[model samples]
Target: MELKGIHHVSAITAKAKDNYHFYTEILGMRLVKKTINQDDPSVYHLFYADEAGNPGTDLTFFEIPNAGTTYQGKGSISGTSLRVPSDSALEFWEKRLSDYNVDHGGITRQGERNVINFRDPEGQRLTLISDETNQGVKGGRVWDHSSVPAEKGIIGLGPAKLTVQDPAPTVKVLTELLTFKQTGSYPSSFKGNEDIIVFETGEGGTGAEVHLEVRNDLPKERPGRGSVHHVAFRVDNEEELAQWRDRLQTARVPNSGLVDRFYFKSLYFREPNGILFELATDGPGFATDEDMNHLGESLALPPLFEHRREEIEANLKPLDI
Candidate 1:
């Protein structure tokens, strides 16, 4: 009946090739899946994660060639965090990002934890959260294969920052409907803005929390490259997901019900602020069609799209991995 922690966060990328190099090489995450966006076969939908493409570890990007810059503002996933092992890992990353010329805001504090904010080549806002004392839904283990040493490798997704004008409706949906508990509130650091509210579910920790920020100063977001498409929460199975679909419908929440993602079953819906949310099953994972050892090495298509692989491949621009 409870949604597990975060499943994955999907964002947009203008150049899949550069996104691949940065995520896999510089950030040292594994490109676990290379496939076409099922809804639009012409572009790539790349997945990056830990040693194995575990549910909580997934960070994905949809290729949108030549997309515009995302104007920083409200009604958006303002920041996405990647969890690391400890504070020392943050030290390694600070030097690493500087060495690679990655834009960063140096290490800072978010409550008791050490956080370093940074941006990708595409200007995607990101934060590295040090999991020094995290005790809830455990983080994924990074393999020794990553360019960054195993200890410093990014483990999994952390709290997603949702910025909006009004937080009451989103808070109601998360606490009342989705069962997330309002854990706490932290300073926004920006003068005159209200403190960011924290909500958690399942085993509640860095991995299962959502941080809501109120911002009346900014306008609605103009999403483009580097913009988050949605954030999904984990469900145990399709049966559980189906029950959730019924729950949403009963409440008249208006959701995309029972989608067969092949890798996972999903039900997508948006909160009152128009930020997308998804409930996704954790099984029939990335290994469903491809061998684990060879993941992301070649193009993968779900069974329904398998017959049209030739057409799909012809349309996608080659990502030189």
Candidate 2:
């Protein structure tokens, strides 16, 4: 199949306000859209990403206000890494983290790149690296809160790193179905890990490497805070999406029926290796809400939510964005 690239990564957040502030103020990601979780309208579903809020650029969150702390185990998404321009950017980011009293650690080199690892307010593990070669799509940074300067903020996605219980099945899916290529493997200097496998989608750089770290000792993951919600891959349109659905069915991979996700259509299923995966269509994008220029400033909903806007707005806790 001809996968365009990543669509978005969805994750769970315990509190709406904390997640909002972390993505907007600290990470410097724009709050592209805010609405209720379609599956459960009582909770908020927030998206953060580059300007345009393009598919591959987004990192979405589902706010389950009353959920308990997430247990970090095996079989769940380990962390997400964002790529910046150069190693120099890490110094600026380090200072920014310190300035905001957000805890972070020193740089550790990974193959050709140097990565800085940190955690969100909700304890989701995140990393930033400097990859000058693939400086992600150029755009403006939104959410100019005092904590994070507009410059040196996140430009776009880097790559999502997953620590799997057994990397074999996952590796098969990547190469055979998803069309990912095995880039190479590297030794990890980070504590408690040995080797990491790097997979590239498109001529790899930022937002391209899907790193898999194999740790046989760890127990399987139990999703909660600090765990990845789901990772989505892009399909050209409904036609291609249906093709992917048929492919999954032929392979006997369990899948969720086609569903409307407002901006795009999507199919959800667990990979043979257990990661939650979604195949989504590419159009009727963020522009569907407000004009492309005015996205994220106000509440935008899918057609289903538009009729309930008043009720959703009233139920959601007020956010300053």
Candidate 2: regions farther than 4 A off: 135-151, 190-193
Per-residue accuracy of model 1 over 1-321 as CA lDDT, tens digit each: 999999999999999999999999999999889998889888999999998899899999999887898998998999999999999999999999999999999999998789999999889999999999898888998956889999999999999999999999999999988979998998997998999999999998989999999999999999999999999999999999999999999999999989999999999999999999999999999988889888888999999998998888888877783
lDDT scores in order: 0.93, 0.76
User: What TM-score, over all chains together, does every model reach?
Assistant: 0.98, 0.92
Best by TM-score: 1
Task: Report the CA-based lDDT of candidate 1 relative to the real structure.
Answer: 0.93
Distance (Å) between predicted and true CA of 98, model 2? 0.9
Best by lDDT: 1
Off by over 4 Å in 1: none
